[model samples]
Target: MTRTTALVIAVAMTFTAACGGGDDAAPETTAAPAASPTTAAAEPDDATDDAVTDDAVSDEGTNDDPANGATDEVAGDDPPTEEPAGDDSSTDDSPVADPEPADGFSWRAPADGEPILIGMVNTEGVPGLDFPEMRTDLDRAVAYLNDHGGLGGRPIVMEHCRAAGSPDSSQECAQSLTGKGVDMVLLGLDIFPGYTTFSAAGVPVFGALPILRSDYSADAQFVTGGNLTTMGVIAAIAVEHIGAQSVGIVSADNIGANTSETDLTNALTAAGIDYVSIKGGDNETDAGFQALIREAAAGDPDLLVSLYSDAGCIGAMRGRALLGIDTPAISTAICAGSDVLDVVGDDAAGWMFVGVGESDDSMASIEFEAMLDDGSGDGASGAGLGALAVTMIGTLARVANMLAADGVAVDGDAIAAVMASGDAPGSFPNGETIHCGVVAAFPSVCGFSLPVGYYTDDGDVATLPGFDSVSAIDYLP
Candidate 1:
């Protein structure tokens, strides 16, 4: 199914699934970027593939009453006293991104002011959704902004909303955040297609990168990132960086994928790479993934780019390990997480993925130190990986804070603008902010481009891509 369909189905059935590994992620410790990732170039599989999902956390953390929609409790807390934001809206399926940003509006403070509450929502270790480590990373991001900057003299107050097991609950969560009179919202619709709800609520979210393509700029929405165009960029990276003359395409077996497949194929062709697929990138199984990887690997492509997930990463690692297909495996930002690096151990050594943030441009380094002070350094390599994660968290918050400081007044729109075309400069890698979002196509923003490193490897596992690239390209996305 497409992202939206998948979400709809996931929510409609009241089924809970675990995604990404839990606290199993250990931070990297070795210093600055070293050892750029090596893919050993070639072609990808002719057959398509998919990503993997983990088991969801207990009902207590997210919501026990899956059938009840978004009235979730705080796991350990008593019953919630608030009314629910019922699932009550529909959406269209056009990938056309919201318009390019218009001339921005300057802040004109209205004298008498009550604090404008900004409602923020993220995957704060949501029960089933663990891929986006919101709490340790995202939470620190907010703190950094508030402590160092504080939005234009008005402090930002955030309410952490949990993602529901079902899409109904997802809508509920969005509605609930809207009902709170949040001036703007920073949200992600990947785990919850709450776009419809937010749109209906007339809340213009700014920071979220929704997986589904809806009217973000309508009275209902606002989007900033280089939307549908990014697909071509993704394909180009697979062809150039991964050196794949030929690639096996994989997509979610849903309407959304169907809509985009033609464009993706055309883009790949325009980029001068060969691609072929038979659907089934969104929903998949371990055994199916293994067979799929085998088929893809058989193509002997220099790069193995799969639209897969952590679970699928695991399966692909195992499948390749079983068959010994050691070419580099590249994927989207969706699967990019520090934890994913540790999932397959030695097998994960050469795994390459993509996503936002410039190495120097992001706040991961600064946040790492902060996390160390906050005690997240315990089991982790302490400052090493913990530091990196802290930096990642700090990066997002810094961007959010900057938008807030500029008084852009919308989370999704501001973040999207920054991601797609924000032009202000900030620290990245060694400290450089070249473009607004990620200027050129993103193999970098699509991923951190980390080389395989381990504490036991006796080399720097903490830093990625030979340090210089961190500053050279700027990892901030």
Candidate 2:
């Protein structure tokens, strides 16, 4: 799922509950229904209290019977009893190995020099939605960098601000950071980013992913592509990989979902393929999911694409299994998360997931594991979005080092230039070559390709053949 979709689901639910529909709204940040690899942003642009209403799902001449609530309630919808687990397996025997930090993605040792003050903004301490781990992970990475000889020997200092998941708080953060004279700003799950404030102050912004339209065209750029890029890749998979002549798409009926569905349909239209769209509420019961899936599969298309995440993932998988509908389905990486997989078990089979792939023993993966290690024998206690934080900071470090090596000032302007220079460089966490400005529609998105995978019979995600890192440029609108 993209940042906007994830934010919409969480924020929309909160507002709905505030408006006296508390029972219907999804609660807490536990396991977000659709928190994908790029999720961590705040509330969405058009997500209001009404966005979570039952009327959001159209009758569409399909649902005549009353909605009988599902017995197998999906996790992540209710208030979290314990801290939410990471996307990786919570099982005892995991596949990831905890190796020492590798040399490839490691930051260079710098001569001791002046400290480079960096500003970071994140959403935290909110009632229903809060993720302090986003900040904690970045702080850990900053400390590690400073310890390892700093940037060009210049120590890195962070000026952190916490947002309360509101535009006022977000703007306050931007305004507050500008006064601190920080070189640049890093955004971590800011719902309504104060981009104009930073732009006027000549402060360049870098974020984990695009959360709104302003994020794409503003002075900021993102490490990961958002919904547009993902939809493009889905289109590529539908037309080129699966050889799908026709497709059925199912998604929640909201601004974010509508936008993403439109994006996919546009690409499908351009590719000359037939498609039917089915929209429903963000949180649906088991029977509701079955109804939606039955309607979608009624056409017997070559493939099924789902834009649902979190509990919806469980519902979809269970609905398919119960109905015996085996048509290959494609969804965001969130649908493949361990939270959902642990619930669905073997029912997760036959679903292809985009945005995430298998956990390999590559140098990049090793470095990622090292960053999460707390010195205990166990792996990273904080993985999920914290991993995103590590990747973003590591990418910034790599860019800064590149500029310093070329005898240029390692400041905001130079860093921005290198990102928009149209040159591809090895990115951290995966070491995949990142090419920014590849998609004209989203110039700020640095990721042109993403790893695609499918679940095996054992309910584990594996890299699909010939789709380890498929580019979305060719299929994008």
Candidate 3:
């Protein structure tokens, strides 16, 4: 079974009470089921409230619906998840040559014998908007992946392409990665045309950005973080957890935020969760935030979800504060900058935004920290970096793992075979790693999402103000 199916089972067992209706012009955050009898039962409870303390990837254990592979179980329609863009239909499926351990697609000296090579690709130079420490952390993490025994004991030969924000550049980058004789395409950033080209060339790629355009095709070419469906699932979770009856959605028109908005709306509808929606409310500066505040407040949503970068996203935050709105905001990694939270100050106190790591998650934390200490293997590094860091490294690991599973000599067929076995169990560098097929289907994303961490107090920075995060539960799932 897929994650979606498992989520349905989970929901069937847990939240059937909330299945009725009522609309009282309630705040968006205070979702109501139209005053129906089912509304009272489906209402949020203290136990569920207690479960919201951390944001690391929880649901670590199994659910009754075990068909969705292992560990992808999520809550039902009361929510969901996004991916990428591309025409991946007509690609050449040629096998590539893995050269010696040094050049592109070359293998490394084995611990006990010969060498094997796995090809990886990265798109360099997309802007970073997450944390101050994330960019460098990502660079270091990739290097660390190389330093350790590459994938499956093979040294990874990587080709890096630069789109430089231009279509021509993106195409050039794609061609360059393809030309390097890679078994698979790895991504730093992605371009739709470039993505289609590579897919047409028969290269299976993985990316940090959710860019997969094909979801149902058995022969689709690329894999992304997820599809738009996952975003919907996440939104449902947010509405249910935040007790949100209304929500406002906005984006700054990047690959990240574009996918975020679509899925958010879908999730709301999936769970019958109502929302007041908007667009491009960058939450960066005071002015931008102020404008977003005007737009968001008109609908009287108790909750806000900003899907832009820091600069613009902060603007939305400022606008809300200036208007004296107490709506709790929920944002994605891109919009969840410390600056936005800082500017919001006391109002930012209870505001919740999603992050990839947890403050007190001991199990996954121990594994991630071990990789950091050991300098990280062909594993996902920077889990504790910013949200983007976790995402980027996770993507990298997915690509590397794909190459290894298909062996040094791989083609589109081999690569797809490895990826199509979505969520196949593996001891990945991250807490638990799973492969997602063709990026289109978004097999297990929702069932495996992280949570929101708070910043320090009203006066300081970060999600926690009164206690030192180093000593607190800094890794929670």
Candidate 4:
């Protein structure tokens, strides 16, 4: 393949974890890039396969009443007391009436207020991996926040540093931002996180998602959990929703991929579900993919999970179709991309997904899309990791607003404390309820719940009933 083609494929590989693990994911404690992931299946030359087999053993408040769409109290909670009917009269009542409902946040910046410096570090300018859209979308989100309410009337000034796909580069960016006295640092697809640097400098760190294994155990905080959480949730879905006793997982054979696979296996074992795993490389031929699928289905498991992304997604789907294996399958949101759908076509039907949700026309959605359009010149769209960056900024603004409303200073330490203490509000834009520090191994994953959905015959996504906001904290390692 040409250099440009290889780079393009690499970008697509990074779009989702191509093989249970991320194509661009670096090992923990190191920032070295992995081999470039391929977008096309190579022609099968040999017929040799390696397999490893192992067998192993929500929200606060009321639960969702599926019958009436109402909240049901927990089994042991005291029942709410009912007031007397038609008790409109009151003794010694004032002339005040109830206040009007709020439309939305309308906090405006104070006159000539000081700017709060928020540091950001993102990977960019790398040969096969670049994500400037992350910074662009975050800038727009900050702009939106400034226009609405500038972090308790103190305008936010973003201090952006670019990392060139290496640990040294990431460290340099962290040092530069810390030297500037930034309040806290936000990470965007940074392979080598500088948590120690920020912690030593007494600066809090926040990121959209935990991309590396080090991120899971880092002192820093992340709003979204990547492979670790996603896989765990998928395992939850397999047991709770699909009612599958046996699950077969097909994954790529990479360090990151194996780590994620182990997470799924552990979750399954904890849930008392049987699971089998099959592995392959990023560049598998059509026949090779079919062979892997056939092997995974050999045991006639109740569910099949494909942890492939990019071209791997297409290969898995096509392999299932070619083999006529109609067993219900599950995959990640990476496979839900338009590029994959356009190629997989109807073959993607009956495939449930983790980390994928149906689109809505809610006001929040409209506002988010509008922000993306408003900053189109800066490549501000909801493709790739741009929307995630925006989510990070919005989440920060939300915590700051909450703190300010309570007469607390809108500083990095306070925000970080609230997040670490699990008192932060719902994630911005989507408002997914989050619980931080719930999983000991994944203390940084504040947003542990994920929306589960499936692809339709027309390639449209739809949410699975009773699977919305599935939490993986119980299954996390």
Which candidate would rank higher by TM-score, 1 or 3?
3
lDDT of all predictions: 0.36, 0.59, 0.36, 0.60
- In candidate 3, position 419 carries an lDDT of 48
TM-score of each: 0.54, 0.76, 0.56, 0.75
Off by over 4 Å in 2: 1-111, 127-129, 149-152, 374-378, 381-383
Q: Please, what are the lDDT tens digits per residue for candidate 3 over residues 1-477? A: 110000010110000000000111222233221111010000011112122221111121233232211111211110001111121334588554433221111122222212322233332333431122332333333334444334444343333333333455556666665665556654433333365676777776544333334322322322223324234324543444455676776556544455455556766766566776665422345665566667866887656766554455456556666787766665543333334444555554434434322222222232233223322333222222222332344334444445655564433345445545654323122222335532333442212233323333322222212111111011111
Residue 38 lDDT, candidate 4, scale 0-100: 7
Q: Kindly provide the TM-score of model 1 when superposed on the true structure, using C-alpha atoms.
A: 0.54
Ranking 2 against 4 by lDDT, winner: 4
Selected candidate, larger TM-score, 1 vs 4: 4
lDDT of 1: 0.36
Candidate 2 — what's its lDDT? 0.59
Q: Which regions of candidate 4 are displaced past 4 Å? A: 1-112, 374-383
lDDT of 3 at 309: 44
TM-score of 4: 0.75
Q: Write the per-residue lDDT of candidate 4 for residues 435-468, one digit (tens) a residue.
A: 6677776787777766665665445555555555
Instruction: Give every collision pair in model 2.
Output: 33-309, 33-310, 110-152, 110-153, 111-153
lDDT of 2 by residue, 125-159 (tens): 66444656666666655655555544444567677
